[model samples]
Target: MARAYNFAPGPAALPESVLKQAQADMLEWGDAGASIVEMSHRGPEFMAVATRAEADLRTLLAVPDEYAVLFLQGGATTQQALIALNFAAPGDTVDYVVSGHWGRTALRQLTPAVAVNVAASGEADGFRTIPARETWRLTPGAAYVHITANETIHGVEFRPAWGAPAPDTGDVPLFADFSSSIASEPIDISRYGLIYAGAQKNLGPVGLSVVVVRRDLLERAGQPRADIFNYASHLANDSMLNTPPTWNWYLAGLVFRWMLDQGGTSEFDRRSDEKAGLLYAAIDGSGGFYRNDVAHEVRSRMNVPFFLTDPALDADFLAGAREAGLIGLKGHRVLGGMRASIYNAMPVEGVRALVAYMQDFQQRRG
Candidate 1:
């Protein structure tokens, strides 16, 4: 059977070439007489893998020297509580931007510990729009201001506007949950104090969450830190404070190499823009047969959610898409419709195939 194009939000599609390389190296990696998964994290061979992965990622994103890239075990969800635990004391407040389901979920985990101030919210509008940065009610002396740069569930993105100076948050740092949009575009690493992303979406496989944090922020995380979740501990031991996920780390290294081969983040941004444009154009030209609710300015290039005018044909449409080798087009259960997650690994040809399928489906159904 032929492989279908996968569009799942997290644990999404990976490049075919990367998978082929992994397969070839699975039993014997670089003539080491052992698989990467069998090697100890502290060994010279594995250390080289870790080092090269970090170097490639740093070059790809232009990560500053002041920031430490931590290959952590926890998913992005773990960072929510960990961030609160590390930064905010029992009575300290943190500013959160409520964008969509993931952002709200992050707040829920943090609320049990810290005082959360909703700096800006698009909840009232059903998360169809992103609140302007000027409208955020940032708390004075807040621990940090957090935003989900792209909300996967809502298909909303917060792109930095050109020629705009950074927002004045006094001494409070900016932390972004860039899980869905990490390598999908080029981000100015200097502008954010902490950026965390689950590797499953655009970077690599699951079980690894990459955290790029300014060194100063780790030093400033008040004492009485949890042993496992402490950023300082991970930094002090070079992400090997405990046994790391060796296999995930190895695969992540491959993904970093793949991204570099594909022309880095700038190329990713261009490809994502082109893919999104094709799909969005299809929806717009559908003559009310398909509708996308996300506001124009903040539309996500990674996840595109749309609803069919005739809800009764939803199942048929999805079944037809699957039959045509365009899989994972069904939207989240909470938002009953269709979502096409075109991550960095998804080829432009895949998006074009999807668009053609949608057009053919719409015409036949109509």
Candidate 2:
């Protein structure tokens, strides 16, 4: 019973070392007599845990002094409406460039409540490409411009580093959904007014979303933000305004430490490129046997989605993958193809193993 290479997106793979640490310390955490799961979020033990987790994350991302990192309870989806509430007033508009599924989800959730302006949309291209920056129709007097830094479902990514000097955001703040791309590489956090990422993807586990917001934006929150959904409140209370997701918070801390031990985000960036490069090279070299729909320029280095020439072989392909100790090759139901989510936790060995299995699968069933 060896471990299988997992390719599932988001509640995806975690570093094995982190899991083992959790396992070894499950029954007793330090001198606390109680496990992390059993500790009070308000107590010194868990508070120190929370504080270190935040500090380590700040170091890992090189977050600026002006930004407050709030470890929140809900996933990124919750941030959509909350962001709208916190940033855009009733009559003021919120602009978005809807590149994929989660971007559209944000659009839908923010509409009606706040005026929604789609600055650009890739839906016309079937979400296979990112709409170029020059073509965007930015709204005047908009609260902020939002972009999904990486579209996990569509395999499209706009690396924050790739778009420095700010991409003509036009005096408004730039807010990015970094859920799938967070910590995958070095980013200029100072360019963004806010960033929200679900911990499940590249961070650690589910149940907590890390939000980094500039101090000024917290001060300028749109009127009538509910207490729980308010950024200012969360920062004021130190993200423990109420009971936070204690265990998930603890596990995320383990992951942050692991990232530091592995040489921070730059190392992860290299590993991600190496891993995803192997997969995409395999797909591109298959001589039309395997094809990916994404445009070359904006193709995701994190989520690699490909389709086989003969759709009829998809099931056999997946079954073969599983037998070869590869798992979660099934594509999203809406997309109907294969997606290999090679996040920070997925090793070079896993991607290489996948490429090897893919070569065998293609030969047998091509």
Candidate 3:
């Protein structure tokens, strides 16, 4: 069967070309006589793969020389907990601006080793909007100010319409969770002290994540932790202090090459806007049949969550979507509706197909 237009969130659709390359390399990689995944992490073959992935990513994001990039095992959540352990000491305050579910999750990962000050939160607005930057109550000597660059589930992002793409934190450095939005556009990496993302969303496959941090931050005498949990140690060992996720790292390298060939982040930026515009227009034009409660200005360009006029129609909607060669439209249980996660891998044609399906569904069931 042909691949349907997938709209699932993380571990989302990968570029067909990347998958095909992986397929070709699966049984044997290069002249190494073993699969890339079967090779030792410290061996030349896998090391070259890991090294190129980071270099290509740096080029793709225009990462600065002062920043160190590490491709580590686990998802963004692991890094969330590690951030405090590596950057903040006991009693050091860390300010957080919670915009959505993942933002709240970031707070949960912290140990009592550090004090947390929630500078701003959109929960009061049901996460339909991001609180204004001016209203934030930043701490005087916080380790860093944290923000979720985009909320994959809540369908909210720090769009230009909201304010600066990266909020100003003054003397305190800015750290952002770009798990679902990384590589979707050109970002001024200098504005952020640290940027991290799970590879599953826009980068590549699952079980791997990327962390880019200023070298100075790695010098901080963070709280006591194992070398394995230390960012500096990970950097010292080139993110191979332990057994790395070789397969995921290799696949991510292929994706970085693909993105660069396809015109890097700028091209994806245009494609994302076009795809999201088409999808949102269909929802906004659906009369009362479809609704996205997110404030228009802050609606996510990556994840678009919308509700049906009748919640009862959700099952039929999903069923019909599957029959129409579309899937992964079911929304998270927190807010039962539907979400179309149009990450970098989702083409404009897919969004067009989705829009057509929505219009047809409305005509039949509205």
Candidate 4:
């Protein structure tokens, strides 16, 4: 059978060209005559791969010289702990803008380690919109302000225009968990003190977290941090503190190159917005047949979550979708609805296929 349209949120779809290149290079990368998985992290072959991947990403994102991009083993959940550990001393107030599920998770990870001030929260709004920054109750001299750039589970995104630190947040540095949104669009990296993303979403396979920290923040991490868990340690060693995730790293490099070849981040921004509009229109056009409650201004261009008007048709919808070559549309268990995560690699055609499937399902079942 032909490849299906896959919308799994992470370990998400990758560019076909990148996968093809990996297939050809799997056994013999360059002249090394060894699979990237078999190569030494310290060896020259993988070093070149590591170097180029970071370079391409830097170029694609326009990451400044003042920042250090470290690819480490822990996913964003680990970075949640690392960010709090590295930034705040015990009992220091840390401000968090809770917008959705992941935002709450990041806040919880910091609770036992720091005095967390809920700067802003949208839970009362059902995770449908971001609380306006002006409304935030920021503590003076808070260690840092953290926000989730995109809430994958809730289908809400803190868009570029809304990504700045709260006005009263003062000189407190800003950090973002861009796990699902990184590389989906261009960003003003200068506004953020640090940014992190798990590679599985838009970058590549899992097992790697891309941590881009402003060089100055490296000094703030408290001592007594294990070398392996230390961002500074990873920065100093160029992310080779121990054996890295070799194959995933190499595959990510290919993905970065693919983005550059496809006209960099701006092009991606246009395509992402375009694809999301297509799917959202389908939901809206269905009248009461389907629904997505996320506010229009902050709806995620990367993940689209919707519910069938008749919940009874949920299983039948997914089953029919799979037969029609549309997969991974099941909603997160917490949300109890259907979600479509159209990451950077999901082509316009795949989204069109999904929209068509939705229209057909509604015609049959509505």
Number of the top TM-score candidate: 3
What TM-score against the true fold does each predicted structure earn?
Answer: 0.97, 0.97, 0.99, 0.97
Give lDDT: candidate 4, residue 81: 89
Q: Give the distance in Å from residue 69's predicted Cα in candidate 4 to where it truly belongs.
A: 0.7
Q: Which model is ahead, 3 or 4, in terms of lDDT?
A: 3
Q: Which ten residues in a row have the lowest lDDT in candidate 3?
A: 160-169
User: What local lDDT score does residue 305 receive in model 4, on the 0 to 100 scale?
Assistant: 92
Worst 10 residues of 4 by lDDT: 160-169
Candidate with the greatest lDDT versus the true structure: 3
lDDT of 2 by residue, 214-322 (tens): 9998877585855988889989999999899999999999999999999999998889878878888999999989999898878898899999999999999999899
lDDT of 1 by residue, 1-366 (tens): 988999888789988988998999899879899998899899999999999999999998899999999999979998877887877777788999888999999888874557789998999999999788789999989889898888899998885552111344667898889899897777788888888999999988999999999988876655366588798889899899999998888888899999999899989989988999999999999999999999988889999999999899999999999999999888998798999999999999999999999899988998
Alpha-carbon deviation at 354 in model 3, angstroms: 0.5
lDDT of 4: 0.88
- Position 233, candidate 1: lDDT: 89
Q: How big is the positional error of residue 163 in model 4, measured in Å on the Cα after superposition?
A: 5.1
Pairs with backbone N, CA or C atoms under 3 Å apart (clashes), candidate 3: none
The global C-alpha lDDT for each of the candidates, from Candidate 1 onward, is 0.87, 0.89, 0.94, 0.88
Candidate 2 residue spans exceeding 4 A from truth: 160-166
Deviation from native of the Cα of residue 82 in model 2, angstroms: 0.4
Which pairs of residues have clashing backbones in candidate 1?
A: none
